[model samples]
Each structure stands twice: as C-alpha cells, then as structure tokens.
Target: MGEAIGQTIPLGVGVALSPLPVVAVVLMLGSRRGRSNGPAFLIGWLLGLVVVGSVALLVAGALGPTDEGEPAAWVSWVKLALGVLALLLAGRTWRDRPTGGHRPELPSWMRTVDGFTAGKALGLGAGLSGVNPKNLMLTLAAGAVIAQTGIPAGEQAVALGVFVLIGALGPGVPVVGYLALGERAERMLGELQTWMVRHNAAIMTVVVLVIGAKLIGDAVAGLAA
Candidate 1:
C-alpha cells in the first residue's frame, strides 16, 4: 500500500494542480449562485476523479497488472503508451500557448458560468476532471500504478482514495476557503483565477511533461526488470 501510494503521488499532484478546473471552481465561487454551485462543482469534480480512477483500476486488475511482484508486461506497455500520449499532449499544449502580447481568453462555455444552475456546474466539473485529456491520462496512470502494486483490493481502494483526495485539493481549497471566509475569499480567488488563466498552458505543459517522463521511466524500469 505504501509503495502504491508512493507511485501515485506525482500523478495525483498533476491532477490536483490542473489549472482549468481550479479556474472553473473559482468562477463558480464568484458566481451569482455561488453558494449552491461551488459545492456542487466540487462534488462533481471529486466524483469524476473517483469514477475514472476506479475504472482504470478495474481494467488493470482484469488485465493482471502485476506478475511476481513486478508489473505485468502488458501493464508496462500501457504505461509506455500513456507516457507517450502525455508527451504529445504536452507538446500540443505548449504550441497552443498564448504568444507575443496576445491575452489568453477563457473558453466560451465559461462565460456562461455566472448563470449556471447547480446541475450544470456539477456536470462541467465532472467533464473537466474526468474527460479532459490531461487529467484523464494522469488519473488513469495513477490507477494503473496502484493496481500494479498487487496490493489486496481493500488496500488498492485506500490508495485510490488517497489519490482522489490529493487530486481534489486543487479545486477543493477554493471551495473550502469560500465556505469559511465567505466574501473575504473573493479577492484572493479572483487573483488566483487570473494567474491561472494567464499561465494555464505553461503549467499544463510542465506538469504533463514531468509526469510523462516519470511514467516512461517507470515503464522502462519495469520492462528491464
């Protein structure tokens, strides 16, 4: 269990620091219906991570992810593939980064956040956490790492729970602050949102690249062993 948790920390951190989700949650907290939408969005984000991580664990388990205390051959291959995918995504993100003096704009859908119902916020949270390419890959890699440890199912659950908790931190911090500090959090969250928006591409590129390199290293080590 410790080993599994160790392996997943980096991946979980990658998910937790995802900029768009943090920005979205900050937007929700500043919205007209913030009181309702903020918490709903947080719940949805957590559920999304849980769902994706659970599915990956199930699939890895089915595939017999470990053999004789090492990752199974196919498991290593899957990690290699995921690592390569992450690198490709990092390249794309880096290429798309705002250049020169051009300002980065939030997506069109985000403009409507001020009027979103709680359900819509919830769904958006889920989509960003579970369906976004970078986040999905990181969560899947964490799941595979947990499964590859060959821990008992219960231990695997614990490790995954830890991963989910860590992954929730990015959006969770703002929601918690809002609940505790009310309007006092507005200024801080707004500042955070602006910075995140400005550097979203750079942050994603670096995080994805680091995780990609780590996954590839792990894969290579597993293959060599």
Candidate 2:
C-alpha cells in the first residue's frame, strides 16, 4: 500500500497537467463570458466539465470490467497515493499561480465554440473536451489505478467515473475560479494583455514546466514500480 501510494504522486501529477488545449480555450473565454456576454465564465466551464464527465463515464462503463491480471498490493497503494499527490500538485499550482495573470489565450479555433444550444454549454465543452487524447489517457489511467487497487468490475467503473470527473476538473476548476474572480481576471487580463506578448514565452515555459514535471513524474513512477 505504501509503495503504491508513493507511485501515484507521479500519476496525479500527469493528470493535473494534461488539459492544455482545453484550458487554453477556457482561458480565451476569460472575462468575456459574464462581463462581456451574459453569464459567468464558470457557467461555461462547469458546463464543459459536465459534458466531458458524462461522456467519460459512458466510456468507462463501456470499457467494461477491470483487467483480469492482478497487480501487486503496492501498485494499488501507489494509485491511492497518486490521487492524494495529484491533489497536492494541484495545490502547488494554485499557490504558484502568478499573482496577477489572466487565463492563457488559445488558438483561434477555440473562439468559435458557442454554448447556446439546448445542450448549450455542455455540448460545446464536450465536443472540445471529448475527442481529445487527454480524456483517453485519464480514462486509461483510472483503469490502472482501479485495477491496481483490486476493486471489482462494477466498482472499478464507478471509480473510473469518479477519477475522470476529477480529471475533467482540471479545466472545470480554473474557469470557475477565474469566473468568480472575473473582476480580478479582467484587471489582470488588462494589465497582462498589454505586456503579455513579450512575456508569453516565459509564462508558457513555466506552465509547461510545471505540467511536464507532473506528467513525467507520473510516467516514471508507474514504470519504476
């Protein structure tokens, strides 16, 4: 258990950093949602999470049962520990996040997303978040974590659903936070947008560095075990 727990530190780290494109899209939404549009950015982000999470659950259910082979007890513990570690890494990012900076901008394609349908926000978020390989990676990672834990099939599906929900949160939480802090984001975006072009490289380097460390750490931890 202790060994497995130790290994998850890296797994969680990887999960924490895997949603760049989605995150970028959420960022581009920025203060534009509520202040600029009608609702808060959180509304859209939360919508996206709900959509992605639902699809992910369906995918997990379809995955249908944990693998037959049993892993060492240590692996399970590592997965459990990885969950905790992922949370910790998230905290580290929260603490280290720039004192004042808007969410990062994304490619022009993301701007076209419109959450006005009957499915509205969730559909938009899902379409963007769904087809991404990151979702597949996390779903697979959830299987690893569950299989290692020796959970039964039904339970494994449930566990995968939950982990994927948390994974979706990588994008969900930030937009919510930014939306709640819309005024702050607006101010920060204002200031940063002015000089962001010059600092974009450095800022991105830091974001990538942090996320890369998380992913690489998890990969190594899984392999090491």
Candidate 3:
C-alpha cells in the first residue's frame, strides 16, 4: 500500500492541479445558485474519479498487472502508451497558448455556468473530471500504478481513496472556503480564477510534460528490469 501510494501521488497531483475544473468550480461558486451548485459539482467530481479509478484498477487486476512482485510487461506497455499520449497533449496545449497579450478563451460551457441547475453542474463536473483527456489519462495511470503494486484489494481501495481525496482538493478547497467564508472568499477566488485562466495552457503544458516524462521513465525502468 505504501508503495502504491508513493507511485500514485504524482499522478494524483496531476489531476488535482487541473486548471479548468478549478476555474469551473470558481465560476459556479460565484453564480446565483452557488450554494447548491458548488457542492453538487464537487460530489459529481468525486464520483467520477472513483468510478474511473475503480474501473482501471479492475481492468488492470484482470490483466494480471504484476508477476513475481514486478510489474508485468503489459503494465509497462500501457504506461508507455499513456506517456506518449501525454506528451502529445502537452504539445497541443503549448501550441494553443495565448500570445501577445490576447486573452485565453475558456470553454463555451463555462459561459452557461451562471444559469446551471444543480443537476447540470453535477453532469458538467463529471464530464470534466472523468472525460477530459488529460485528467482521464492521469487517473487511469494512477489506478494502473496501484494495481501493479500487487496489494490486497482493501489496500488498493484505500490507495484509490487517497488519490481521489487529493484530486478533489483542486475544486474542493475553493468550495470549502466559499461555504466557510461566504462572500469573503469571492475576491480571493476571483483573483485565483483570473491567474489560472491566464496561465492555463502554460501550466498544463509543464505539468503534462513532467508527468509524461515520469511515466515514460517508469515504463522504461520496468521494461529494463
């Protein structure tokens, strides 16, 4: 379990630091129905992470992710593939970064956040956390890492729970603050949102590149072993 946690911490951080979701949550918090929508979105985000991570763990377990206390070849292969995909995503993000003082464009759905029902917020949260390419890949990789450790099922659940908790911190922190600090949080969160939006592409590029390199390194080490 310790080994699995160590292996997955970076991947979990990758998911937790995702800028867009944080921005979305901030937007929701500032909306008319913020009191309902904020927590609803958070719940959906947590559910999405749990579902995706559980599925990856189950699939990897079925594939016999470990052999003789070492990762099976397939685990390394999957890591390699995921690493390559991350690099490609990094390149794309870099290409799309705003330049020459132009403002970055957020997703069109973000504009509709002000009018969203709790249900719509929930669905949007799920889609962003589970379906976004970068987050999905990181969560999948974290689950695969946990599975490759050959821990008992209970330990795997604990490790995944830890991952989810960490991942939730991205949006969770703001929501908690909004609930606790009420309007006091608005200014701080607004500043944070602006900074995140302006630097989103650069942040993603660096983060995805680092994780991609790490995954590839782990894969190579496993393969070499």
TM-score of each: 0.97, 0.46, 0.98
- Candidate of highest lDDT: 3
Off by over 4 Å in 3: none
Whole-model lDDT per candidate: 0.90, 0.45, 0.93
Tens-digit per-residue lDDT, 60-116, candidate 1? 877775446767887778789999999999999999898997889888988889999
Model 2 Cα lDDT, one tens digit per residue, 30-102: 5234333222333443344444444544553444433654454444344444444444544564565454655
- Judged by whole-model lDDT over C-alpha atoms, candidate 3 comes out at 0.93
Ranking by TM-score: 3, 1, 2
lDDT of 1 at 209: 94
lDDT of 3 by residue, 75-137 (tens): 888899999999999999999798999999999989999999999999988988899999899
Error of 2 at 34 (Å): 4.0
Candidate 2 structure lDDT: 0.45
Number of residue pairs clashing in candidate 1, backbone atoms closer than 3 angstroms, sequence gap of 3 or more or interchain: 0
